[model samples]
Target: MIRPRRPERKAPPLLPPLKLYKAILRTHVHKLPIELRSLGDEYVKAEFKAHQNIDNPLHIVGFLTQWQDYLKNLDGGSWQEGKLSQEDLDKMSPEQVNQLYELMLETKRLGSEG
Candidate 1:
């Protein structure tokens, strides 16, 4: 008997609900988890991609322009602007937390040195 191999699954696209995406960018974190965070991320990506295509035009041009501006300023450490909450860190086990924090700090140090 021949066995068949299973196909690999692709990561789902990030296309967020319009209102929820705006809310997240607005820093309404408490309400975010009440809905679906993963779904929100998916929707954002999908919308961004859709607007990026030649077929359908959208306001994404402004967003892409801002991203380009940010990239141009990437010589400094502006890439890492946001902070992760202590509550979020505390939820992880000590080993995982230490590893993640160590890697994050190392990345920041390297970015700052350059």
Candidate 2:
């Protein structure tokens, strides 16, 4: 008996690795206006400064949510968004550097876990 052959099916691409995801999240946070990005991050840093053990993952997710809202609001404001160029990283304030580090660490942890 002759049987019909089926076409090969390929799986969808896997989501980006966690390192990339965290970097995106950190970048998103850094690019937000100080007013928009400050509250949650200040909370995280304050807790850290107090020597409290904070949930780093939750902090990252919370920041991600805030960043998304900022993106939504800046939906058409490219001019403001333009200021956060690659050049800006070198000039980032100490707090921004810390946030970036925290985000990258969380992302690396997520990537390793998966």
Candidate 3:
């Protein structure tokens, strides 16, 4: 009996984690509001550190894609928040929820300052 040939898999492109991390932090410094810049920097640092050892190509691509989109939005001054659904909130850890709250407060504070 003849066996069917398996499809060839293409490898995902390699992304330099440290370089991307620095680039994103720099973008945040320039694009984020004064009150948010530090918080955003910390968040990115923690996140990058957490994912520094990721070996899954698909996961790496997804992560890079999301951050790239975020950087683009920041560059364009189009960063905005949308309402999180109940399910979305349920999926977040308490710390994540608190961070969101802090982000909201930062935005309000910046608005008042300006």
Candidate 4:
């Protein structure tokens, strides 16, 4: 006998990239500290620009999902307490790991300067 099919769960629709980018910059980034606001804005601009030509649905979904989570964290005032889980770090490619390291160093440098 065949097993019954489970109902498919639908994810909430994501905002379009341009709209989400504007929300992050206009609504969220300005709430950050001066140093962090500049850094976050630059990073967000670069990330969005880099992904502008991406055509893969999964990649787009994943990118938007992570950014949406970031927006939520900022809105909730818990963004400063966020940390990368080891499991999430393990999934990064070598280039991504290096990029993360560079960002960390830059953050530290800014922190020391402030």
Candidate 1 per-residue lDDT over residues 1-114, each given as its tens digit: 998989989643333335334544444233344244344355445655665554423445444543344333333434446465889677778876786676667556655655
Q: Is candidate 3 or candidate 4 better by TM-score?
A: 4
Number of residue pairs clashing in candidate 2, backbone atoms closer than 3 angstroms, sequence gap of 3 or more or interchain = 0
Q: What is the alpha-carbon lDDT of model 1 when measured against the actual structure? A: 0.49
Better-scoring candidate (lDDT), 1 or 3: 3
Which whole-number lDDT from 0 to 100 does residue 92 have in model 4? 99
Q: How much is the lDDT of residue 32 in candidate 1?
A: 40
Task: Tell me how far candidate 4 lies from the true structure as C-alpha RMSD in angstroms.
Answer: 3.6
lDDT of 2 by residue, 1-114 (tens): 998999889743333334333443465475655444544455444533553344586755554454444444444456253434578688778888897778667646655655
Error of 1 at 32 (Å): 25
Worst ten-residue run, lDDT, model 1? 28-37
Give me the runs in candidate 1 sitting further than 4 Å from their true place: 1-79
lDDT of each: 0.49, 0.53, 0.78, 0.89
What is residue 13's positional error in candidate 2, in angstroms? 35
RMSD in Å for model 2: 17.0
Task: Compute the lDDT of residue 112 as modeled in candidate 3.
Answer: 84
Candidate 2: Cα lDDT at 44: 43
Query: What's the true lDDT of residue 85 in model 2?
Result: 59
Q: What does candidate 4's lDDT look like per residue over 1-114, in tens digits?
A: 999999999766788899889989985445788888888899999999999999999999999998988887887888888999999999999999999999999999999999
**Residue pairs that clash (backbone atoms under 3 angstroms), model 1:** 14-42, 14-43, 14-45, 15-42, 15-43, 15-44, 16-43, 16-44
